[model samples]
Target chain A: MTRIRIPPTLREEVGGAREVPAEGETVRELLDDLMAQFPSLRRQLVEDDEIAPFVNVYVEGEDVRTREGLDTEVRPGSTVILLPAMAGG
Target chain B: MVSYRDLLAQAKAEIDEVDAVRAKDLIESGDPVIVDVREQDEWDEGHIGGAVHVPRGHLESRIEAAAPDRTRPVLIYCAVGNRSAFAAKTLLELGYVEPVSLAGGFTDWKRNGFPVELSAGLDARKRARYSRHLLIPEVGEQGQLKLLDSKILLIGAGGLGSPASLYLAAAGVGRLGIVDADVVDESNLQRQIVHSTERLGEPKVDSARRTIEALNPDVEVVAYKERLTSENVDRILADGWDVIVDGADNFPTRYLVNDASVWHDIPVVHGSIYRFEGQVTVFKPGEGPCYRCLFPSPPPPELAPSCAEGGVLGVLPGIIGSLQASEALKLALGIGEPLIGRLMLFDALNAEFSDVSIRRDPECPVCGEHPTITEYIDYVEFCAGTREPA
Candidate 1:
């Protein structure tokens, strides 16, 4: 199971859980499992079967987009971070 | 007991001595560490071109710092070679391999027309004002002077700008340009420390200028009582700046600042806060990835909320803004590693700080090799998702 850390802005969609555990070998499988559990997250995190352009996923501190995108492998117990551009100053 | 002349003669005989002509040749040819053991006042008047000043009284304690490698040749000098002979003897006793005294000192060198470097040192007040900075090896006299000569333009005077402006002013940043169109409100007192209750209705730029000037008179504040739009960005940025501190409240201004900074070739210290989280980074154009590289497009308005709508922790901006000030100082001084390609995220709730690498995207429109968007566009409409960004 990989622990996916949720940003504060997206906490509402995950019942305010700071981190939620999901089971998958790749980022695609992890998000699939997560979206299946929390249904609302599908629209927020994915668009047209790809990670939303405005949303960035990091697998173990490395941006998944820089790696293999959704196909990037996720090791057991690895931490995943979902980040979006924040424009509040 | 021997007389002073007898002691002097013995000291001179014990150490190697070089004439002014020979000293000049050695300086021109070899990398000798020159030590000027004259008093502050005398050294400030004039000294050798590349000499480190260590007064006679501080010779034993400060010599190691001035010349760390004892194996290197040390050329010691005083007014007339008398003091340097004793200084050379001291260096020899301290295990220096080759310590040579000037046979005729600075006086003889000056007589022979050797170049002398006059010190443009800080005044007594400035020395005392920046004493802590002077004590740091990385931010010593030179770095402090650099700070005093630097000019930074801040995009806002609220929230993040409060702490950033205050710290930069206190640090003696010579000139500061603050741009804001809002007036201080009672609600802003919770976080905008640069504005006081008494100046509630006053313009934010004016309030900030007053506070910064009162804190440190060394800083000159240029107040712009207007918002930063695409129309005025060019004219405002025309007044040259060394670095920019972006603390804008909305996405429009943020994108405008980024685009202008890229075109101007200026480094920007960017900070933003929302609720319990804050992000800080240095977007240095031509050196690393720009804002466009990090966030190619602004998130939809639903996902992207302003600090006003979502609310931010009182001290969140303070923490983020202070980091921006630190990064700005590092950029101005050219010391240490600026956060050029790293995005630092601070979670106030968890009290955790994490960073991730941000690489320049080859397809970035602004900073990429083949750019499409050459001129500034309607940032407001663009950030609103109404108009597509090229």
Candidate 2:
């Protein structure tokens, strides 16, 4: 089991919980499991099978893109965070 | 000038980049101080909450004040990672410990749904009182509310405090705390306009409270009628003021105020006057010169005369304190430059105003990168050290 931290803006779609637990061996599988549980998060995070440019995924404090994108391995109990670009003062 | 490509390459080679996960871990573990090296405008739009703002252009100058410890872990980031790379390299070169650039800046941090903060809006009555300020696009409703929420501390009730308190109260500063241990004397009426003849013999803080209350009820004035010594300076200033106005008359209190303000990282609006001359500057810790940066040591008492000893023109405080008030307002509203890194001099005799550029001293005792005096010192003794046979 891995934990995904949801941001404030997306909390409503995740039953208003800040963190949700899912199961997977890789970032792609973990995200797939997360989307299966909360279908609304899929479109917000994925665009045509690639993580949207606006959405960033971090696996255990490392950006998955800098590693191997969705192929980055995630050990059980690893923490993943999803973030979208925020341009504010 | 070096080409951008070469500069970026050189900076990149000298620094290490941390992936977003490592940066997050550092933050979660509370082991690193996060710095946003973006322009002010970019910062106001959105930034990682709790990240200190030390823009890339001024990183070297301000980093010491923002993070005084050379051994603290620092996570530096910009819009992307490029500017932060240079910032990280500079921090390392300056002896900062464990400096790293966030691999992906706020852009990616946000895109991935990371937490970002937006400035909240203003309320209605405030919108009406500061409508004139709101007319200016820069200080519209958003800036007005910031002003209403700002806490300003004034160190004296004489001279400079007169005009500074009056105008700041009128400008709608939310909270103004005044510290004055003296009672209003007949001589104070010469320049301390905030205290009238009828208020003579009353504590200056009480006198000032009456004046501010009459001018604007919107402002709340907290009066501390005790002199600020090393013992109480820290406790009094601990409440967290947005800005501090150094209106103290003596060198000891001035140095005490400067040291405390530097230690707390609060910007101080410094003003002083002689018979026909006065000077004003915004002494921002680390970002610009603290008082000690300009005057490394206080002058010997024989040479340093207070306004009480050397007669001052009655209107001197009005001119100087008004300028202090303007600077405080600008600082609170976050609109216009706040006179940081520059000292403005006014000579009433010649009716001339001059500008002196002030640079932060990398070696300043109080705010230097390797600061020796992190805690408040016995300022009286420290200033007196300058008087010894030198």
Candidate 3:
């Protein structure tokens, strides 16, 4: 199963699971599975029905934004991480 | 069953033997050395009876003085355990295999029925030195330690230097180098925080030194009671400082500090205050760019307002100076992202902090490829446009 990890901010809606498994052939499908499981996170990740500009999706530590923007393929047993742009002084 | 955060803490806690009673027992039996890894303010308030103070950030460098023997067992603790974790890790990296952390830190020690010695710290006697800093969310213990371990050079002890030096010293920078040739003047007390009204006729460095020393005895205040010109800019900046604060009230000394800091490969924490507003930037050589990249040549003197000509608010320096200290500490600790490529602007009247984006200039004279300026230029000559302070 493809794994979808949650950030601290979004963990509350997903039953506090640090990571959850999803079934999908592509990154978009895996995200849809995650959103279906925890509906609140979908709005933050996808806005106006699109992925937020600042919310980045990374697969294997590489930004998926540079690949397919969100439709990038996801293989079974792969890790998907979502993070906000870190900016603090 | 611990979570990741708890596991990280447990891992750190596991390495530490947090029992102050055990530490007291160890000290009683002469089993280990108890090193207080907090800053001077923390150390001054109180520490274990036999504890030696060696700030965590400077742990690797000043280890020998605090713990003379390499084979002696050492127990280190901070206000809480986080910094001690870093201190213990640093010692371990330095081949201090026998050292262990005082788990839960001093905070836990007191909770566990251990006695805590109190220091005045932000609880200053006169208006409390740095009481505002304690209120800032980002400027707490982690920030305080960064302030303490930081090594910053202040190029002047006048108006701008007044606030910068006092706040930095109060925040607990381990070493502060003050360079100024002028003696304290009655007019200076209106702005320079380091010089008191009673210190009217004393050397500016003397006034500043006594202020910081009396405030936080943990800091090593060095005074270079001479004007910073081309002759001594490089020689004086030989301390391998982490940041250089240019609070000089003049453009020539300002450029001199920037150029020298760039040459030494240190971040120039530049702050220039005029009337109601101040501009600050971290010019790190070869990283984003140097000050020369933004202003290749010095401004034609009269255009810039000297603190004397423009008249600054007495409290304005306090705002900018504290900001300079914050930036310096952040640069030293290697924790949070640095303001290296960013310029923080403050408008006192409006009370606004706007971060302006700054990018590397390939055409920068100092840090650019095929750089024309190879060495520190003479400020006197450069200002005169006569012969570049040679």
Candidate 4:
């Protein structure tokens, strides 16, 4: 079971659960499984099959986008935390 | 003497409380008389527009005059929820039928981007002087008044402070306090534009004040002709400032400003410059990671050369200082998303701006959950320890 932790901004669109469990073998599969349950989150997280530029997904502490994007390996007990870029002063 | 927690707990048990959302709803729906019980300076920075002003100490004596009707819904708030809880209990005991405490208080209200109004005080002349600012929809009458009522403490009057203070003063920041111990040097002419050729030997604070006052007579500049040592950091910040602008060039003063500002719950607009690079961020205590959270400790002395040693581009401070001024104004207005958890890196040579996401370290020495540094530490000694390169 891979745990997908949602940030506060996207919580409302996904039933407000801070953490949701999904079964997948990779980062892409985990996101697909989680978004399948909550379709509303798909639009916010993904745009035309690519992760939104603002959203960053970290698998086991390393940013997956920097490593392998959606193809990053995942397994049971792996934690994926989503953080959005905050462009500010 | 009774503990503050005991009093707050007792008050909580005795009064009804409303969250910031519910409090806003109450204000929108009916004629609830909102009263802010924070200190006078905090109230001046920004308050829930139309909220009655009754400092917690005087609430019992002045509540009736501010909101006399016992039947009316009286909502009260302090810095956080604690003081307001006690104020609510006092209001309930004063025979008010529907007295409610704002659960998270003014800080929460401000963080939510709710409307805040300054008390009516800016004269027509001052308003006309700020006509250009008022023209912008984001910085209209309310924002201009907010600018006029805000107090920003610039930790240095050189380099970064030069442009930041100039713009802040021109923007009609109600009170601008400048802290700098050094005298303007001939070398400062290259970057510290706040001082002129004639004012070379004058104190930086004095020189900066003269420049700012000349720029805008409406601004009141308080000159602290002294260094920001650990001894005076708390004392200088004790009066409570809306925002703290870190313009210091040294590691010790920079860290001192961070710790003091964080302890006081005042957001710090931080900026730093090297030879051709600069960075800007807002170290909002409890809101995001502080300077300590970002650097943990100063870079080894040799690695972190002074501006004199590592010659900055003359215009670099102008760019980063302008950003600091912008951040301070945003904080004062309680509008726009500040760089609370983001560090903006600037490369002058390449003219590139990149942002790095910075999160608060839960184990951070100063701002962590179980923190070790409660008060200001010996930052000078801490930074002076020359260590071997790892």
Candidate 5:
């Protein structure tokens, strides 16, 4: 269980609340619970059992998708940030 | 007495010319002509669809005929608007009513995110209806919805189709289909400004399809490179197309398009531009004056002009074709009063567009009570044009 910080772009849907607490033993657990709640973020975040390309989800300013297969253990109050890479012409 | 757009020099001083956004605004205001003064190459890349291209490099030579009235107010634009400013000032000096310069050059226009057209061959009409649409409250959003939900079929990739096609694409029409069997030609570069030399030898449909795709993916383009003859006209018309805009230059195919639209219960947004004059009308057979109601019969085959004979003024279609696009958009949007019973006559020579209402003919064939065109039949004789096979 830890606190997850939503990005500014997506803060509106989460009740304008910058941070929220969730119960999850691992990254996978946390993401599953988040997706179950928001639903729309699943397509943008997950694909083929891994984080989708262009997406960067960080735990305490650290990239987690690269280090572990969503099994990164979380402390009781760790903050997560979801960000997607930007591209332009 | 003359426009600076066709200047012989590289752009002497900077003056704002009419870019597409301001041009569209003036067009929406219900008056003013959009005149482009870019070189042929620049125009081919992309110019305002309905803008008359006089080429800044050739201003003095064409202004007299392009804007015959020394007193007519015109908005001008060039690559950066400098040449056009020169042209506009010269026009003012010449006693033309008024010549307003676009705030920036076409490049500045693109940078500012304004609409410009890029259809090759004949650009179909792209003008939006100027009157009364904005006055209606019930139609605002609902009409835009209808336009987004509708699919219009455009015949030909030449002058008439170019403007029409570009406007429909920009106006956010849900789906648009371009049907043509020819490829791009250098001579067509003069008036058929949509296709670039880079796309030379490419099928007209493929060229138009790619242009639409690059410009806006939201508007799905279903291109048919095959000739739209009577044989397959029915099948193509049956695709639940909301409206059919006929730009076919020849008689047989034009009639074929008309008959198909009538049978399919789809409206026909009709447009045709000759040397200096053009005709525009909307047809749904039973609901309004059919194409037959206006022309009844095709002009003699020998007299019809292909790109070769009736050299279209590079910007002539830009005016009429865009109107066709506007009419099609209005029909789809259901926001404004459709040109259903109206005929628009435009004269670029005088830079004037006049409108007249047309009445349905009860004695007509297809849409008339006792009809002659029932089953899908051949129209080979009508499709005959003396020009090279297109």
Candidate 6:
């Protein structure tokens, strides 16, 4: 199980939960598991089957885009952070 | 009891005395802690290069701070040899291994054509105002002077800009240039502490200037009652600035500022806030990754909302903006490790802080090995999602 931390903007879609537990071996599988529970997250987090350009997913403080797109391995109990660009001053 | 001349002769006989030529040799050959035990006026006029000033009256109490290692050799001097001779005797009593007094002090050193350092020190008023900063070894008189000579420009005078401008002004950043097209709104008072209820209808730049001037008269504020756009960025940047603070409230402005800063080769201290969370980082052109490297494109309106759309916690900008001020100060003074390639995330609700590493992208449009976008484009249209990012 991976603990995925939700950003404030996505908390509404995640039912106001700061974190949610999911089961997966890679980033793709984890998001499949998470989006299965909440269907609306797909529109915000994904674009045409790839992670959205504006959204950054981090596995243990390392950006997945810098590592391996969606095929990045996710160990059990690893912390996943979903970060999106914010423009508020 | 002995007379003053008798005591002076006794002290001179006990301490080792070196002539001006010998003193210069010791200073050049080795790293001896040099002490000038002269009065403030005399020391300020001229003294040996790299000498720490400790007046004769305060020698016993302050010598340890000037030279903590008593085993190292200490070369003491004054206006003439008499005062330094007594000071050397005092150091020997305090367990110093070797205390050598200059035979003719600064007078002889000057006559020998050796180097002398003259301090353009602060006035009495400024000395009292920044006394606390002087006590710190890292931000001593030198660092404070650097701050007073620095020139920083701010993008906005709103939420994040309010606290950042206030703190930077209080720290005595010599020149501050503010760019904002908006006026002080009644709704801004919740977090925009730089403005007051009395100045609700005034322009943000004017209001901020008045507040900053009142806080610290040492600062000079330059007000630009216009938005930062490609057409005017060159004109504004032509004024010259050492550092830029970005606190704009929209993606278009943020992207424009980033591009301008990269082209101008100036470091930017960036801060952004959303409801309960904030982000802070320093975007140095060549040293670290820029905003384009971090986020290639802006999110669609549905995904990313401004603070106006999504209300922010009142104190969130205060925390993030103050962090920006600290980084700017460090950059101005050339001290401490700034957040060059690190992004700091602050969660107010969780009371937690985390950092992530950011790296420069070789394919970045603006700052890359082979740049494609050499000129500024329509930032508003680019951020409006009218066209997909390349």
- Each candidate's DockQ: 0.52, 0.01, 0.01, 0.02, 0.00, 0.55
Best candidate (score: lDDT): 6
Model number with the top DockQ: 6
CA RMSD of all predictions: 3.7, 30.4, 18.7, 18.0, 26.8, 4.1
- Tell me which residue pairs clash in candidate 1: none
The digit string of per-residue lDDT tens for model 2 on B1-390 reads 899999989988889898777677788886788899988668778887778777788787777867888898999999889889989999999999789998778887887787887635344566577778866646655567677788999988888888999999988899999998888888778778888999988988998999999988889999988978889998889988999988877767777888989888899998877666677889988678887766655544433444554467889889989999999989888768889987676768669786656667787788888877766655443223221100
- lDDT score of residue A62 within candidate 4: 60
Off by over 4 Å in 6: A47-49, B1-39, B48-76, B81-103, B381-390
Tell me the tens digit of each residue's lDDT in model 5 across B265-319: 8888887765566678788666787766544444443323343443457787787
Candidate 4: chain B TM-score equals: 0.69
Task: Name the lDDT of candidate 6.
Answer: 0.88
- Which 10 successive residues of model 4 chain B have the least lDDT summed? B381-390
Report the C-alpha lDDT of model 4 over B48-165, residue by residue, as the tens digit. Answer: 9887667788788767767868999988998889989988888787889999999988889888888988657446687679879865656765688788889999988878889999
Q: Interface Cα RMSD for candidate 3?
A: 15.1
Q: State which candidate, 1 or 2, has the greater lDDT.
A: 1
Residue range A1-89, candidate 2, lDDT tens digits: 98897743356679977689999999999999999999988767776798765455777655576578889999988768775421100
What does candidate 6 score on TM? Answer: 0.87
User: In candidate 3, what are the lDDT values of residues B110-160, reduced to their tens digit?
Assistant: 787766655433334422444464444455443555566678898777656
Candidate scoring better on DockQ of 4 and 6: 6
How would the candidate models be sorted by TM-score, starting from the highest? 1, 6, 4, 2, 3, 5
Candidate 4 local accuracy as lDDT?
0.78
Top-down lDDT ranking: 6, 1, 4, 2, 3, 5
Query: Which regions in candidate 1 have their CA more than 4 angstroms from the true location?
Result: B1-17, B26-35, B49-52, B56-76, B82-102, B381-390
* Clashes within 3 Å, all models in order: 0, 20, 10, 0, 48, 0
Q: Candidate 4 vs. truth: CA RMSD? A: 18.0
Which scores greater on lDDT, model 1 or model 6? 6
Backbone clashes in model 5: 48
Deviation of model 4 at B98, angstroms? 28
Candidate 6, residue B32: how far the Cα is off, in Å: 6.2
